[model samples]
Target: MEPINLDKIAFQITLHGGNSKDLAYDALKAAKEGDFDKAENLLEEADKEFNEGHKVHSKALRSDDKENRIVPTLLLLHAKDHLMAARSEITLIKELIELHKKID
Candidate 1:
């Protein structure tokens, strides 16, 4: 089997996760401005980006399982942080958008 490029995987996760988080925030802003259509579109885009990052992370985990172990690294840790933060922010932003709609 080919060796895993942990750095590349981590970078991909970080990139996609960060994009997801940024997009989610933008969605929230659009919702607050009463642009529900734009907000929903942005949220969809954010979900796609988050899925891309999650796919990369899952692949790494699967590879690790097959190899019996994968060494921890600072970059990997940071990538995981981004992944988690993006997920949480996305969920919260969606709820906030709904609340904004109700309030408006």
Candidate 2:
């Protein structure tokens, strides 16, 4: 595929990844405030955004032929970094939310 196309996908991944992370953080905030229902809803929204980002990343990876893989550019790497960090943040925040629920 063209580099411009790859850049577009990378930008999308980063955007969705950032959205996911923000939603996760919002969920944690809601949990801290004892609004468990809202927290759960936010968590679901975050998961959806995360999945969208992951799908774009997967599509970018799969777009390449077997003989020649997609070249990872700096923007792509940055996007991946955002995605992984968001994933980890959401996972940990889920645990933290559960703990908060138990405490409450």
Top candidate, metric lDDT: 1
Mind giving the per-residue lDDT tens digits that candidate 2 earns over 1-104?
A: 45437789889999999999999999999999999999999999999999999999887777777766788899999999999999999999999999999999
The 10-residue segment with the lowest total lDDT in model 2: 1-10
Error of 2 at 9 (Å): 0.8
- For each candidate in the order shown, give its overall lDDT on alpha carbons: 0.95, 0.94
The per-prediction CA RMSD against the true structure, in angstroms, equals 1.2, 1.7
Candidate 1: give its CA RMSD in angstroms: 1.2
| lDDT, model 1 | 0.95
Q: What's the C-alpha lDDT at position 23 in model 2?
A: 99
TM-score of every candidate: 0.94, 0.92
With a 3 Å backbone cut-off (N, CA, C), the pairs that clash in candidate 1 are none
